[model samples]
Target: MGTTSNSSLRSAGSITDVAGIEVGHFTDTRRPTGCSVVIVRDAAVAGVDVRGAAPGTRETDLLSPTNLVDRVHAVLLAGGSAWGLDAAGGVMRWLEAQGVGMEVGLAKLPLVPAAVLFDLFLGDSTIRPDAAAGYAACEAASVHAPAQGCVGAGAGAAIGKVFGIDRAMKGGIGTASVTVDGVTVGALVACNALGDVIDPDTGRVIAGSRTPDGKSLFDTRRSLLRGEAPKPLITGTNTTIGVVATDAVITKAQATRVATMSHDGLARSINPVHTMSDGDTMFALGTGKSGKTLGMMTLGTMAAEVTAMAVVRAIRAARGVTAGGLYLPAVSDL
Candidate 1:
């Protein structure tokens, strides 16, 4: 929470509260695999941070402050492991159809940076998200908060993978927003981690690895410290990807800083986050629509808080699923 003249928080409760932001999702009904799009149609300056060692990303180098691209049309988060990166092409096509992008020579290139999380373990791996799924997500874009949990990029996400899928619980997308001093800071997260999900406010395990009976949480961190053996990890099996946005005016470097600091949110919510098998990535966007500003410290701090809120929301909102004889329980189920 930043010191705002108004001192009251606006309650849209999603990242869309940030001006010029829209969210859309495309979920494959056959299985929990799909993508979500965050459209910054007004050309928001963007930056990114990749903390997980096994990441699947596209166009991220261009988002660096040193790069030529100053802004991005959209950020795509998808479920399908590395294959999901193809969804970015669909987003590009959708944006090009609407004539959105940077004009270089005779071509308008819609800059869309994307990240993918592994959900291939669920159901049919071959039926992953594709370009059509990406375009369909953009087609469903809306100014509303968009559906959360068990949808879009979060569809196939799961946590507690440190003990394998049998002990894992469902993870999904969540979002939240806070207005500070007339500037709105919002976060959207698709949380699929290789650890337990904790409640930042309560400092307690909310979801994640479960006991053998599947009736209680194992508290993964404590278990590991107490000598419980974690299953062998396959690279790229887990990841948490998302975006943080604000209406405050900020430079590309500052945006990058925000993205970096926002990782604290994941640290707060996920025990043992940013592991080798996970590919955690976050992007920061500045729409500058509020015509307002906050100090880098305050803005970055607020982004982290909002991001944590979104992560917790993701766990709380997730729904249990049973498909193909595989049952992945959600918070509600336990």
Candidate 2:
């Protein structure tokens, strides 16, 4: 197993000691355009758990612990609304060619897991990633690790606005890692939170709802208490999704536990998370090389921290976009 000293670990930028995990993205900048693919680790044991009431998810059934496929070669996070789910077919095709899939009598079946978020981009409806785009993403996965912020699933992602887009903030993909006793666990998130992204340690809003002048994003609770009419606008059509990868030896069941625990990190970093307007989902992947021993609950707690850190990283790495005469800047850009 790869190891790094605890004393040398850092939280800013990319954390140290996170090994074997690789990320890749394919982005289309056209209107209703977005990004795809966030491979956590090569040949990873993976699982998923969803906690949103109005989630628009796909491939969740494959995460079951009893599934014959014990490992997932890649995960695709893309923007194309529900229609974009078709992108996974391309990934499946690629994996089939690589001989990475479930083996039957005569042929191998690909077991690529995928998830998506709706970025309709003001109802341009025609916009979304297709099978070709998915293939492009798979091709891109062959290169260096992914680039965060305003890319991939986050390309058209925005946050805030229980009110309207005027208060939405730019949110994208962010990553962070931590090491404990020589074991490294890292997280990457595609943040599209309904609530503002906050620094858990400081309780300060780093991103989320913001005024046109680039002021504080509105608080949903405060707005409700003020008797403001609830805007059912498509403003909060967001979903934050990503993976937690570690070198630790973990089973699919344990990975499921890690995915469940990671939600706490979302709750910590984003206010009023797991809301109806948000299709929040998380995945966990174990690379099966870190010979560290950890209790299920302890690993869960670590997952939460790493998840929160990844959310913050995504917010901080975001960039501004001009939409509807409004300048929506990323959390860090502001």
Candidate 3:
């Protein structure tokens, strides 16, 4: 929704439309965990923001504007909590083989920043994503919209844990993109929140904790404000990670600002987000391949919108997960 000469309000439908971007997902259903790799054939300036108190991240320090690294080769979002961080190593291995990344004396160290969401509780906690899983994701990379919903890092994703796992809803990966005035902005999100997912346009709950009967929806915010019985919380079991890509030419600092503003999209679509137990993080990447037709302010605003839409898409596209006698239904199932 920026000032575009084209005046069209539609996108090419996925992040790949941004050009030079490829998305890949490697899902290990046996472990009920996987990783998603966002590959940029051409180096792209990157920035990140970690809002949650508990986060498992790798190579984030290098993303700083003051850091020597100006661009990133890929970003990995995976399941398996802290142990899943190993997946990043696999991505690095693949990139190095392809001759991508900052060149060192004898080797090119691929700069891949990664974040993990807790999904151990959803499947076999003992089986976690590892280096092999990361390499598989890179090998599976494609230029089209990656598979969404209960696949990739979202495989074990679950939402509305405020009332415990029994009442939680299925969470997964989703994507949305918009092209305006020849500038395209897109977002891909792995939604696994500790609160309810809302439809911002309608202001109605789409998914969240349910009553004991698993029939009526429970309002997590109202219950907290009313001082009802304290809901049990499983610390370090939730988080949401995502990426925002644009063709606009922007600096690392500006990319950081875009990441900051994009959090507004999470707030708009999720109630009671960024809690202590969640490790919510987002990354902003700029390809700088297109002319700067829109101001930074306009691009930032549109990024937020794209992110919010991606959140809604995540919930809508999610598929039910059932393993070890635990059943979590996607929004459509309900």
Candidate 4:
């Protein structure tokens, strides 16, 4: 197998191999909500898949097998609980103004794919990232690496909630990339797992459940074995969404396979993932830049490894904050 480890490439910025893809965020710290936009190459081939039992997806039809041949211009990741779906409307408006969508007769429509995760339960339900925020995020996109952690869609993200906010830890967005046979495959994830994040290689808990006293969160297996029912709390509404971008040419089917492989990264970095509480999802985009040829399965596996690394980075980049006299650790401290 090709080497999947990326410990040697440590820098506080986006991966260098995945070129032409830009990221931007519009955050609302006062309200604990925000949105992000990931702009692939001006026109790239893209595909998507949603495996979570409960997911909030938008513009999925654009990734259908028939739609795969067309070029995908952009993707939007937003916050507002389920209500955040409106953010896409703003993106559409901007794209339409730029003539970035599908063509119909004499008119050119913008084809922007988007996805969303829930964050309303974190703060004031009344406040959310509106259409204006979506436009702002898109306007901020550039070639440089974008900010991570409690910025963008991850602004209100939290984890380790089998016992509510008392045990939840700070979670946010992260990214990683790798070169395979001269082809670059990169991944970015917004982590909000129900369980804690573990460093699989070291057997250490990097992030996850926390104590009310602001200490490391630990396994609660012993408490469960005692025949006590798990805490009946509203802590299961979490999800992790990501995108896998590659320069290699691939079909929609291949893109879907890459997405499935990316989930492997999630399983490695997060404990008890794909659970009813977590709505984990992944997307794949082909930039059509690399000339190398490879099997779909091979790319899938590599995508998974990169995805896992990105998720860990997201956790490690979080920043701890205090709320209601309680201190919450951010990914940066992990």
lDDT per residue (tens digit) for residues 182-213 in model 4: 66788778887776776756756677775556
TM-score of each: 0.97, 0.88, 0.95, 0.88
State the lDDT of candidate 1 residue by residue for 31-96, as single tens digits: 988999999877999999999999999989998899887799999999999899999999999999
Question: What are the C-alpha RMSDs, in order, of all predicted structures?
Answer: 1.8, 3.0, 2.0, 3.2
lDDT (tens digit, per residue) of candidate 2 on 1-334: 2124445433543322345555656677565346566543357788898876557666678788988666877777778767777888887777777777666769876666777776765335586888878878777763243577888777777777566667788878877777667566777788877777888889877777765465665666566678977568563377888787777888999998899999999998888788877788888888766777567776787788878887887878788887545567765565
Q: Model 4 has how many clashing residue pairs?
A: 14
Model 3 earns a TM-score of 0.95
Count of backbone clashes for each model?
Answer: 0, 5, 0, 14
Looking at candidate 1, the ten consecutive residues that score lowest on lDDT are 1-10
Highest lDDT against the true fold, candidate: 1
Residue pairs in clash, model 3: none
Estimate, for each residue in 1-334, the C-alpha lDDT of model 3 and write its tens digit: 3234444433437777777788889899685688898988677899999998889899888888898877999999999999999999999999989999887888877989999999877757888889999999999998777778888898888998897888888999888788776787788889889988888778788999888898777878787788856466778789999999898888998888888888998998888899998999999989887766567877887788878888888888887878767888888877
Error of 1 at 91 (Å): 0.5
Q: Tell me which residue pairs clash in candidate 2.
A: 35-152, 174-314, 209-217, 210-217, 320-329
Q: Scored by CA lDDT, what does every candidate get?
A: 0.91, 0.72, 0.85, 0.72
True-vs-predicted CA distance for residue 237, candidate 4, Å: 1.7
